[model samples]
Target: MLRTIFLSLCLSLPVLLPAASFAQQKSWSGTAEPRNEKEWIRAVQLRVNANAVNSFMTNRLAGTGRAKGVAALTVEIASDGQIKAVSIRTSSGSEEVDESLRRGVMALPQMPRFTPDMQGDSIALVIPFALHG
Candidate 1:
């Protein structure tokens, strides 16, 4: 059987900042740490695409009964672009799916290095993945 899966990306910042501040900034160039929520979202979207989590989940879930739910994950990325850790803030109602999502994120390669402007050795982001079939 052929299964269809749709992946949606939603990012939640650790600290809520004024939208006006982000709106006034120039677009992120993908070279340094993201300066605002929008830029950070863009960076995360790029990393998700590079990691191919959608495809990974599709393949991983093939022949399985579980396919639809939302999983919220907390990811910590080091200044050097390495993924320091990944934890599930909310599960997708299935251990299989949750584990698969975690594995998919953990497979991500090095991301953009954080700039001094960011002021942190590592950053934690709450990313929600919506999976639908």
Candidate 2:
């Protein structure tokens, strides 16, 4: 009985293994070009977007004794055109205003495109968010 049970367990162990282990993994080894015009374009666009949102937020707080300096916000937008994550990369010595701005941008509409930063089929991009008074 012990040997039968052991043999049965051994036979079923293979079946119990995860399907992922046997499945082929998709390759993400695409080429990337970090330094190029596309990167500059992406950076400019991100800066523009960030500044626009910040300006709108500042306008809303007008006449409320708001003092503005500068802040660097970091936002990650996924390929699906959604703000996946947002955080204040550098605060202008004011957490309250930084948090407000971050929330404001997060609430904005999704960016229209995920334009690839590329050179000869390789692609890379760094989108930055900058706000200034």
Candidate 3:
């Protein structure tokens, strides 16, 4: 009976290990939670979309872009939501495309700001820009 039980457990171990690792990975991923102050991330996204239209970046992209790949940036924001610094973590391969994205980021106006209780000294964001025809 002891050997039979041990064999059954060993067979199940392989199946359980992948599931355990997946759950662990999902938890560690820095996804946003709908906490009060943290909501600024959403606001920033919306503002970026709106601000993109008719801006200097419009000329840089040349035409309607269909989102080829994603780029990344590390942005430092003060407790007041003012951007302290902007650093590009990953490039979109083309210098023109990367510079266009940079211009768009620099054009963003001061946000509505965050309260003192907000966590984190800064946040890293992934920006996906489309590829033009």
Candidate 4:
């Protein structure tokens, strides 16, 4: 009986796995957007952090020493997940660092799409970044 159950479970995994994967994809692909503004902001932050890490790993970012600073940027993201615009809300005390951050955000190919429940054509986010040398 145990062997039969194990065999049945194994056979069912392939069918179950695809359904799970599709549901996950649908959730992030804009079918099920974040439930609120806070959740949306968190999602955006996560994506930015991930991109920054990837860029740093690839040596695409400026030298660590030069990039070190704290900065805040007001970014406008379209409902479709495009970065519409980026403006520095608080400077990093270095024009180079500020511009670098702005350019990096603008260069992104895409961002998380606005949650379907979110009310607006676009959302503005004040994202803070602190780089350590």
Judged by TM-score, which candidate is best? 1
- Candidate numbers sorted by lDDT from highest down: 1, 4, 3, 2
Q: Which residue segments of model 3 deviate by more than 4 Å?
A: 1-35, 52-57, 64-67, 130-133
Task: Residues 1-133, candidate 2: write the lDDT tens digits.
Answer: 0000001110110112232211121221222322444443343244325443444455554334442555555555554335566676656566665666666556555433335542232222222333333
How far residue 12's Cα lies from its native spot in candidate 2, in Å, is 65
> Which is the winner by TM-score between candidate 1 and candidate 4?
1
Can you tell me which runs of candidate 2 are displaced by over 4 Å? 1-60, 63-65, 116-133
Please state every model's RMSD to the true fold in angstroms: 11.7, 22.3, 17.7, 16.1
Better of 1 and 4 by lDDT: 1
What 10-residue stretch in candidate 1 is worst by lDDT? Answer: 12-21
Error of 1 at 67 (Å): 1.8
Query: Which pairs clash in the backbone of model 4?
Result: none
lDDT (10s digit) by residue, model 4, range 18-91: 12232223225643446776666666665555444444434534455655666677778787778888898878
**Whole-model lDDT values for every prediction:** 0.57, 0.40, 0.43, 0.56
Model 1: lDDT of residue 55: 41
lDDT of 3 at 98: 54
TM-score of 1: 0.64
Best by lDDT: 1
lDDT at position 7, candidate 2: 10
Reference-based TM-score, model 2? 0.46
